[model samples]
Structure formats: C-alpha cells, structure tokens
Target chain A: MPGAETPIETIISMMVGRTLSNDALVIPDTASQPVALEVRNLNRGREIRDVSFAVRKGEILGFAGLMGAGRTEVARAIFGADRRESGDIFVHGQRVSISTPKDAVAAGIGYLSEDRKHFGLATGLDVRNNVALASLERFTSPIGVLDEAGMQREAVSYIRQLAIKTPSDTQEARLLSGGNQQKVVIAKWLLRDCDILIFDEPTRGIDVGAKSEIYKLLNALAAQGKAIIVISSELPEVLRLSHRIAVMCEGRLTGILPGGASQEEIMGLATLREPAMAVRHAS
Target chain B: MTDTTAPAPAAKTGPRISGAFHRLLAFSGLIALIVAFSLASPNFLQTQNILAILQATSVNGVLAIAATLVIITGGIDLSVGTLMTFCAVVAGVILTYWGLPLPVGILGAILAGAASGLVSGTIIAKLKVPPFIATLGMMLILKGLSLVISGTKPIYFNDTPGFNQIALGSFIGQIFPAVPLPNGVLVLFAVALIAAFVLSKTALGRYTFALGSNEEAVRLSGVNIDRWKIAVYSVTGAICGVAGLLIASRLNSAQPALGQGYELDAIAAVVIGGTSLSGGRGTVLGTLIGALIISVLANGLRILSVAQEWQTVVTGCIIILAVYADILRRRAL
Candidate 1:
C-alpha cells in the first residue's frame, strides 16, 4: 500500500518518518541538550583567560592545544587542583563553587593528572589501596577501620573489568607498568562514582598497545553515560576519539569544531593567537 | 611516569631480593653488636644488666615511636624532646601544684602535648613552613617554655603517692616474679603494638603512609591532607606525653633541662630501624629494634668503662653508618 501511494504522499511520509527510522545515525541526542559540565570565564589571572566550554552527558570533549596553550592550566582550574582568580563552574546545569579538589570531587568531577607518578598515584601503596584510595569512606567502618576484604574484592573486580595487567592486587602500584598505573588511576575515579572525568594526557607515556586499550576504556565510560574531557597534544588522537574538539591558543579557547574536522583546520584554530605587533602596547 | 623499557620479570625480582637482604642486614647487625658487647663486658649478658638496659630504653623507645610516625610522613619532629619535657612539666603542675588526682595529671599532660603538637602542625601545614625549620623553632620555643614554667627547677612529684609506680612498678613481675620486667617496658610494648596495628589497618594509618608516599596525590583524591598532617603531629605529641610520664615517673621529678638531646637519640633510633628519612618506608617493629640497639650500645660501652664523650662519638658514627647502609641497600635495588 505504501509503495502504491502517490509520489507527493510518499515524499511527505519519508520526510516525516526519517527521524524515527534512523535517529541513531542522524544525530547524537545529547549534543543539543543540557551539558554535564560547563566552565565560564575561568581566569587564573596569569596563565588562563576567559576559557569556556561545555561537555554534555555521554560525550567525549577533546581539548586540543599546543604545549604552552594553557590546556593544563584550564584543567587544573576546573578540577580545583590550582586556585583560579575568577571562574563560574556548572555541574549538570547547577552552579557550584569549587575551591578545592575535595569540592570538585563532591560535585562528581574527577581529575587524573598528567604526571601519574607524582600527582595521580601513591606509588608505595598496593593496587587494592590505590583503587580504594578515593572511595575509601565507602569501605571504612564507622570507627574508621578499613574493610580490607571489601576493598580487596572491589579492587580485584576493577582489575578484571579494566583488564589491568598486574601480577596481583597486592602488588605495589610503583611496580606496575605505565599503562597499568594509568588504569589504576581510572579505576580509582570510577570507584568514587564520578560522572565527569577529566584525563590530562591520558596516554602520555603509555605504549602503543596500551594506548588502544585506554581508548577502548574511555569509549566504554562514555557509553556508561559519563561525560569525559580528554586533553592531548596528539592531533590524530584528539580527532579520532572526540565527538567534538575544542582548540586553545595562548590561554584562550579560540574555536570548537566537530570531531571530523580536518587536521589543517584544527591546527589553524590552535595557533590563532593575538598578533605579535598588537601585543607590544599591551605589554 | 618514566617508561622503563626494562623487562618486568627482572624488575620484580630485584626489589624483592633487596628487601629481604636489607631486613637481614639490620637484624644481623643488631645481633653482631650484642655479641661484640658481651665479649667486651661480661655483665652485658646478665639479666640485671639486660633489665637495666630495657629500663633505660623505655623513655627513649617511646619518643622514638613518636619520631617514627613523623619521619614516615617525610617529616622530622625536633620538638619531640622539649615537648616531652613540657608535658612532664604540665603533669608536675597538675599533680603537685594543682593537687589533682593521678589520672587528672596524666590526662592533663597528654592534653598539653596534644595542644602544642596542634600548634606546630598548624604552623607547618597552614603557614607552609618546612617541617625541619618549623619543628626546630618549636623545639626552642618549648625548651624555653618548659624552663619558664618550671622556674628552671626540677618539679618533684614527692607529694603524689604511687606516682613512681607508674613506670617502676611491674604488674607483670608481681604476677610472675621470675620475669622481673618493669612496667615501662610493658608500656613500650603496648605502644609499639597499638602503633603497628593502626599503621597497618586503619584509615588514619593509611593516610599517614599515603601522605609520605605522595602528598599531592592524596590532596587530589579529595583528602584533607592538612587535617591528617595535624592529626599525625597530635598523635606524636600524645606519645610524647607518655614518654614524659615515663621519664618523670622514673626520676620522681620533671627536669626541664634533661630533654635537650633526646630528639637526636630518637631520630637516630628511627634511622637505625631502617625507616627512610625521606619518608614512605618504615615499620613500628623496626623502630622497636632500633631503640634496643641504641640502648644496648650505650649500656655496653658504659659497662666497659668507655668515656661518656667517646660513647657519644661512637653513637654518632653508628648513626651515619646505619643511614649509609640504608642508602646502599636502596641503590642496590
């Protein structure tokens, strides 16, 4: 009957029914919806300026910038790793003040620092302790004694789920490979039930094989309905993984584009700084 | 993270072997010291001499335990000695001057120590002062305060009945006459056991290790590091209170000037126990053994009629050798 319908009727029906038939391929549903995290006018007075971006739920927001483009500064500000001069942060459309990393975590935001050895892990602690580090309160008794068995069980589960390669859950974190260490940090945040994860240089020192594994993990986390922000210097990595990419230049966010943007286009936005001649008077 | 291309299997065996070797080195060195001392002085092996050495170890052993916690957090507490004196002076004030009950005096001394430790911790954490300089300043301050509080005179606890019994009296020996161990040694064992349990089992204990291992990482994990740091110092201060109680109980008086060099002895004991002064690696059991080694060395040399001045020199050299040994062990790993 539909095939026998008139040309005008069929054209109208196709136009109206297109979304219902192929909505999954047509667009990402959350792209135009409310954002999970928003940063506005985050200025640290010296290193950062007027950085603004939004990451919707179930999306991977890639931050692509050069070495001195203030990517880390912005991330630190958002995570409250460093004090910001002025900024407004919104989590799930609700404005909140983040003065410390504790406040950030309380607001369901987690930051995995670029320097894994110094800032992302306690190298001397065992794997189970590292996984339970952030969410220790969950396994702690009322009198402050840790539930060692519960922690060990949870850690082992994460190790299995994440496929983190370690000899045993009791192995000291420092003894693990770089990729495994990164996975441990990720497991820590996940155990804390954080919905928004900011990973700074996720694969900085990881091997090629582990890099792919980490990529799979990030996608899996996004599929689990968590918003993720990935900061990377590798353009191909950013382009390949991001749903949308934001570019920064000289402490300011210059532009944002779709994931499929050309490499030349991204590089152009990444270098869009103020003219050198114009800076003479300002200095 | 430095991506070491070294094979995982090789790296694994290296640290394991070195760990066992370091423990063996420390234990054997202690045994060797005891054998050498017994050969030098026949009295060194006698039970009375052993009891005397243990009695001498009580106060210093307690202080060394306090030092162990601070050092494991990659910090030094130079104020521990003077803090002990201050606590003893407070106990004197409560028991003699205020004429309070024995329990009140004990509690008073502990509270005073905790309060002072809190001040020092706040100065270090909030003011961003380095532990060495801050505790050094605090050490001087407490030293001056102790003297001022006690009027530069020893406060005798003659009025307090059974006060000396706190350290000298042995309930264990009363029950089993053959053992004849002082109550102070029991206190040391109790403290070491409790500290070891806490360091290995509790959230507070884990934080202490984590703070030493990587403070920034802890902060990023949403932990209130400053509060935990203050707690560590406070716990140290409370332990110093117990040390104060032991020393005052032994002497039946609080001597403000007697505490000037105790911090050095305590720190030396901690180092000899193989606790890394750089932080993160230490154990209560190791600290207990270290305390014994120091006391035994001192007692043996004294029994051999070595000059006190020469004894001091030997102790200094031994401390250097112990730390050097630790460095060598770490380098081998």
Candidate 2:
C-alpha cells in the first residue's frame, strides 16, 4: 500500500516527467479566430445523428464519448473515409464536396485513423515512402517517375523535424515503436500540407514518454494554425489538451464544454440519453 | 520523457539480413540444381540443352513476372495462362487470319492483354470482388474465349515470315556468334529489367507495394486506390500478353489448349522466387530466379530420364518447401 495513497495524476506526472496542472498550459481562444472546419447536420445512418460542430484555426477540439458513442464514426464521415447519408462540410467558410478520402485531402483535410496498422501506416514500406505517400505527386516528375533523391531528402527532413526514431529513412515502418509510428503518420499529413487533421486515438497504444511527446506535438501543431480534432476516450487527455470539449452519446452531440469542464460534467453529458435534456444542458 | 522505448538499431538488421539470406538461398538452390544436373548427365550442360531450357523458361518467366506485379499488390492473377492464350489468339487473328503486318499484330496483342487486364481490374476494384475469385472467373472466361476465338485449333504463324523468329532467333547470337541465346530469353530478360525498374523507380511501383502492405492505409492517405489497383491489373495483363506472344512464336502457332496449365507453373515460380502470396513483399529478380529453377529442374530431370509425373511431384514439393522457408524467415524476423 506504499503507493496506494498517491493520486493518478501524480503517477502520470512522474511517468511523463511533467506537471499535470491545467494552469501550466495556455489554451487558445478561438472565439475571434476564423473557423477552419464546420459541419452542418452530419448524418451517417444510425451511427451518426445530425451532428453539427465547428473548430477554429489554431484550436484543439477534443471529442469525448463512451466506447460506442459514435465519435470515430463522426470523424470518419467528416473525413470522407466513410460515406455519410447527409452532411455538409465547410472549410475556411467555403462549402466543399467530399465523397472520398481523396476529395477530403484535396479539400486540405487529413485523418489519422485509430488503427495505425490497418488504416494509417503501411508497415512493409520504408519510412521515406510512407512520409511522402500522401504527397507523392509533388515528388513525381511530369512523366510519373518518382524523384527518389527528392523524396529521400524530404523524408530525412521530416524524420529530423518529427524526431522519428528510426535507423534511417529507408527503415521499414513496422519496425518502429507505437509512438514513432504515430509520428510517421503525423509526418505524412504534415508533408501533405493538410491544414485540417482529425486524429482518432492519437495516443492509444503509445507509452508514457511518447504520449507526452505526441501531446507536445499536437500543441505545437495547433500553435502553427492547424485545426485539429482529437478523438480520445481518455478524459484526462481530453482535458489536458483540448481548448473546448465536445461530448457525444449514442450518436448524438450531448453537449460542448470548455477545456476546464469538470470530469463529472463531461460524464453527465457523455451518458445523457434524451436530446431535449442535452439541448438544455448544452445551452 | 526520454525516448527510451525505441528499438535498438541492431534489432532492425534482422529483416534486411534475412531478406538477403532468402535470395541467397534461392540462388544457391538454382546453382545446385545446375551442378547436380551437369554431373548426372554430360549432355545437361551442353549449349544446345541450355538454350532449350532458356526457351522453355521464356513463356513461364514472362508470365511469372506479370504474376509478380499482381501478387506484390496483395492480389493474385490466375488468368495469366489463359489470358496469354487469348492474346496469342488475338495476335493470330491479326497476322494470320487478317494478314496484317507483323508490327501491328505485336502491338495488337499487347493492347489486347492490357484491355483484358483493365476489365479484370475493374471487376476486382470497382465491384469490390476478392482478387482470387475475380481472377478465377477471368481464368475460365478467357479459357473459353481462347478456344472460341481460335476455333479449338492451333492457328499457325506459317504465313508470317518473321513471327517464328521473335522467340526462336537469337539477336545476341547474331552479334556474339558463340553464345546463341534465343530472342525469347532476351525478351524475358528485357521484361524482367523493365518490371524491376518500374517496381523500384515509379509511383505505380510504390503504390503497388503500399497497396499490398496495407491497402486501407493507402486509401486513407487520399490515394485513388481503385485506380492504382486497376492499373496494376492492367499491367499484369499486358505482361501476360508478352508471354502469349513468346509461346505462340516459339511454337509458330497459337495453341488454345496449351495455356491452361501454364498459370500453375508461373505461380509456382513466383512462390519459389520468395514473393509472398499474402502480398506486400517480393521482387522481380526473385521471380526470375524462380522461373529459372523450374525450367532447370524440368530440363535436368528429363536429361536424367526422370519420368514427367515424378518431375511434377518434385516441383510441387519445391513450391511447398519455398513457401515454408519464407514463413520461417518471416517468423525468425
């Protein structure tokens, strides 16, 4: 029982080597900032209801929900990775048509799927190729031949910038750890010049050290004016990183709260069943 | 926190070493087959016999390369043999039946292959059909079509003066005077070189491996996955066309019934070449070496008066051994 008396926050702080106070971080004020992504009544069968929300430039929008609350479904619908029954996605105040992930990327949106192995990283390919995968056309000549040297140079630079721990750019992605693999996925979106990024469970499988790094990286990316929506099941993580939190339950947006909203408040909204009650609580 | 969990550089070397080791094992196997054959019969290493082995490999080697492209994308092409026959029939119609020029016939056959491949790709990618089933259907369709087109008979290229020379004549022999390597082998080498280069240096090649590695990942990366998949299949079909021309030219006829069993051999060669059936990991060189192994085994066995049935048994055993070896290598890594 020696460590039983200690709080979870203290243990997390010890593991991450960082203070766990909300006061230590500066949350961005997005009231005056331009809206980077806005969705109007997004619907995708029974998985997602008429969900509408907006994230401003330089804002980290934390999506909070229970295990089956359809948070990932909403994100995938917005990113066009999954088909939506009815939805309108507006980027930079302009409505965009997105029928596929290709169209979403063309509209400057990137999605890092929660399952990295299945939907984010091509484990067999080397790091250089994965980093440049999203933006391959930039590295290709007019004749469709890839400029290998240019791709290598760009991959090496991203490896340095993202601090991806790999032996070389030529190292296959599967060999890297969870944290580094996440960084490689981040690097891919970054290299693609995607201004709007939806990261689903960004730190799901990462260790304490890499989780903090990813947190810092997300903060730094938001500071650079990237509109980020991080979908995480961990409430503390949502509270630690989000400027505003959006809570969902049973495919409906139960409520949206500020970053400093208490755990009890989020949990209340998370389990709220009635839409009428959610509207009252949201207001 | 410090990044203490990163794998050590030493740990990363395991796969690279084993990849090289696998290729080395395959190459040594090829060499061992040759040495064994030469020792068993003095006639096995003769220049004429070697040329005959190369000639036999030309058709299967080209088909295997085509299969390599598709297999690397985590897909299989079972229609390669019949598709080859179909293309040869197309070429026969152009040159022998229509009496068109030889260049036109050659171009026509290649284009025919590409078109069939496009159809297969569209079926697989757009219809969301599994590659195995899609290509299996294509195999039967093309087989029936080949028989129909050629009227269930061999379409002879006797009227086309240089048609037989495409595979039989040796351009290198013309220059070297002593080597006398057949043009079919030259074509095989040329196809291998181009396929290897495309797999290494082009966007298509990169996507091929990426699609096989994690197709959903590639699609999520904003790539047009269907387009690329279709393209891979189309290219595969075109390679099969080349194989068709080689087979037709070598025999001086388009034999519709001759191509049904060739796919098994091509796929066997691909497996023996260290290309994974599950997709995402393989090489053109590995496939080339594999094709050579098959022909060498077949030719060497015949030279030693081994029965054809037993030769097939040996080949079947070799395929299983090659795949098992691959599994061991992967598990070790």
Candidate 3:
C-alpha cells in the first residue's frame, strides 16, 4: 500500500499527516541577490582542481555529482576544513583569509560535515552542550565559568523551534535519531549565527518523514536569507531543493544549470569530462 | 510511508542513573574495604593509622588529578612521575644550591613543570605526534634529566626553613586541637575541591571532555582544539609540580631515583576512581576516592602482614576488575 502512493502524496502525508491541495515548489529568483560567497580558482591537490562557483543570498545552490567526484572536497576547501593549495574566497564582496575552521567560522561560514559521528556531533555530550559548544563564549562569564542555566534555556528554545524529539536537553546526543542529530548540528550553527552554511549530505541516512522536515527547514532557512550550499548525491533532492545546480565530474565543475533543469541535463554534466566550455571556465 | 514509525526516544533517565550508579558502586566498594580491614585488624580503625593512610594518598592523589585532566582530553602523560621528580630537583637547585628564597624556589619548581608541559603539548599538538609516544619519550627524557641535574644525589631542603612544615605540619590541629590532619592531606583536599570546580564549572573542563568525546567534532565546531589540548597538558604539568613539592617536603629531600614506578600507582588510582581510561567521562572526586582505595588496600594488607609482593598482586587484580566494570557499564548503556 505504501509503495503504491505517489511521491507527492507521501510527502504531503508526512507533512500534515493527511492529503491537502498541492502547493507548487517556488524557485526563488536569486539573480538580483548579492553574492554571499564566491570562490575563485580554488585548488586542493588533485581532488579539487581550479574549481570555482558563487552562491548568492537567499539561494539554495545544490551540488550534484557521482561518488568521488570531488564535491565534498570543494566544500571542505571552502569551509577551511581542509588545507587548500590555493584559493580566493570573497564573502559579501570582501576577501577573507580562512586557513582553519576557526577562521572560517569567524568569517560566518558553518560546515555540517557528512560524517556526523566523527565531525558533526560529540555523541557523548548532551544536546544542550553540543548546541552551545560553538557559541560557548556567549554563555561564559569573564572569569571563564560557564552559565549552564543560560545554555539550558537556549537549548530548550531550539528544541522547541526545531521540533527535536528529545525527552530533555540533557539527553546524550548519541541516543537521538539521525534526523534529530542533524537538527542539533543545525542548531549549533544557528546559535553561532553563521551566514554561509555548507551542508554535506543533509539527508543521507534520514527517514522519509524526517527527510521532508529537513527539506522544509532548508527552504525556511533560505527564506530567511541565509546562503545555503547543499551537496547531495540524490538527483531528485537536488531538483526539488536548489535554486541553481552545479554539476561536477573528476574534480571539475562541468556546468551550472538553472533550477527545474531536467534530470538528464544534470546527469549529462555529472559525467562530462573536461569539455571545452568547462576547460575555458577553469582557466 | 510504512517506514514512518517514530524512533524510540532514549530512556529519559538512563545516563544520569548509570553515572550515579557508578559513583555509588565505587563509593560502596571503598566502604566495604574499610569495613573488612577494620574487622580483620584492630589497628586499621585507629585515628593514627587513618591519618597515615590519608597522608600516603596525598602525593599520588595529586598526580592522579593531573592525569585525569590529560586523560579527559583523550591523552596520556606518562611523564608525570619523572616530571614530578624533575620539579623537585629544580626546587632543590633554587633553594639549596643557588640559595634562593623559599617562595622563589617554590615558584621556580612550578614554572619549570609548566614549561616542560608546554613543550610536551607543543610536540603533540603542533608536530602531530601521538600523545602516548610523545609523553613516553618525555618520561625517559625527564628521568635522565632529573639524575643529571641532581648529580644522582638526593637534594635536601635543609637550607629552606619551614619547608618540612609544607607537608608534615598540621594547620587544622593548630586551629581545633582535636584532629591533627597533616598539611599534605589538607593539600590533597584543597586540590580535589579546586579540580572538581574546574571540571564542573569552567570552559577548560568542558573542552577537556569534548576533546575526549569527539576531538574532530570539536575541531569542526570551529574551536581551537590544539590550543585547548596544550592548555590541558600545561595545567596537568603544573599539578604534577604541586605533587613534586608535596613529596619533597614530606621527605625533606628530592630523591631522584624514587619516582620511576609512581606513575603506575597514579594511573591505577585514576582508573579505580571510575574515570574511564579511554577518556571523555571522569571526575576528580572519583579519582580521590580511587586514590584512597589504593592507599587503604595497601595499608590494610600491610597491617594484616601480607607480603609486599602479594599486595602488588592484589592491586593488579583490582585495577583489572575496575576496568572490566567500566566496560560492562558502557556495554549496558
């Protein structure tokens, strides 16, 4: 019975728990928006070779590629989670030097890594602590003592706002579902007030109901004018979410397509290898 | 659509209950040891013998506290024992050989310890050397340096007045005239209280657990993890400096060769106190109780005329049991 349901019906059922009139997915026109982040000729060994792109304000720029196509590498380079051989990153038209994740965060860039267990969540710590970790200075006194009550208050607020299904803020992060864990990561960046968010595999292991919730959350964040770059291997996810799509193959950005581009168009560019137009852009 | 069942929320009180359970288990074990020893030997319950056990625990307790900080960062400082000796020798050179003021000598020892710790931290953090190997190398280097600096001789604190009082004197007896607790026990309690506060209430303590729990995650959170790790090691070294002073003042001499095996005792105490050897979760109170447990076991067995070798065997058995208990607790979780 579930297999017979249409994709829209499933999403709708997951959203409201019942069927409703269809609302079209609006593709925001980001052409006139200011460029929030721009990378010029970013190079990182062989995995990322002279790759460049720009993400504008209020835009969901989806990165599409096959496995090992260097999409994650480019995200890491831009976020300064990895050493970049050479690159110029301009945030809001000002070039900022970011060599470490600390500098990247100081420059208002947040990276939600694909490896949630190792790089996104301190599973042994509680949800409140994890959410407050990136912004601990705000909850710390001049004498370096933590304001635990304040942290707990903020954590409870985020739990309610994000609909995180935890019994309490003190619940250990490892015990939470994958979707809730991802929300905790999102709450961390939100608390840090990061302007540029790079989400790698935002819904990789999440279930369908939680997956729809994440999609809604991402669209809401873009609606709030946050610059979001989503790197997902799922073509339908890219098609449904991105205002613009960037396709990569063999460490090169093969092409950029507008939102609503056909799956065949994305697949074609995903497998394209150093074509003349792609070569010209690299130079 | 059929796969939309909500994930079972974790038991609301699981971790909290288990944490309290572990501390209770350790505490009850300590109490059981005290009772058994008291029943087996009449002298074990005496006030003097009790004071002796507390005094014996002082140095190792302080050192174990130091290890707790580093271990919570998922690091091991094998150099803590020799580093303590190295600090004592530095104090000796300042107080006896150089004829410096007592305060200066004390400050010199602590600063020397901090500097050595800073070096160890830099090697591990900046050079990307693993913590175990770096500290192991530091352990040997410090042991050799202690012998070289002290000229293979014990450095006496005869030139420093009131030095022996630093550990042997009883400030509480001077106040109440009832309980004559040694200054060393007082120092242990003070150190434990301060360490507990730091671990619970300070940002440094937060990062210590975070680093152990998931270091890469902490780094990706935009934290300067290297700086924090280095700070943890430096603080640990400084605590070892305090331990050095306690031992030196207790004996009125810095015995260079007397420190090689002390590290094992300190680590044992930390493990028995319910602090995870793998890091992340630990407590200073647990360490203090752990140190007390070791001291009690040693003193009780000695009172009952157990051979020193058998005492060591018993200790080895306890350490294994404690670690196994921890593994079982984690598995239950």
- Report DockQ per prediction, comma-separated: 0.28, 0.53, 0.47
What tens digits encode model 2's per-residue C-alpha lDDT throughout B116-213?
Answer: 99999999999999999999999999999999998999999999999999999989998999999999999999999999999999999999999999
Q: What's the candidate order when arranged by decreasing TM-score? A: 2, 3, 1
Candidate 3: give the TM-score of chain A: 0.91
* Model 2 Cα lDDT, one tens digit per residue, A4-80: 89987678667666654433457877789999999999998778999999999999999999999999999999888
Q: Estimate each model's TM-score.
A: 0.93, 0.96, 0.95
Compute fnat per model.
0.57, 0.63, 0.57
What local lDDT does model 1 show for residue B111?
A: 91
How would you class the docking of model 2?
A: medium
Q: List candidate 3 stretches off by more than 4 Å.
A: A1-23, A275-283, B1-12
Alpha-carbon local distance difference test for all models:
0.87, 0.92, 0.90
RMSD of each: 9.3, 2.9, 3.3
The best candidate by DockQ is 2
- Residue range B1-333, candidate 1, lDDT tens digits: 222122233236456566556666777878998999989878899988898999999999999999999899988999999999999999999999889999999999989988988988898889999999999999999999999999999999999988899899988898999888999999999989988987888888898899899999999998888998999999899999999999999999999888989999999889888888988878887788888888888898899888889888988898898889888887775
Clashing residue pairs found in predicted model 2:
none
Docking quality level of the chain pair in candidate 3: acceptable
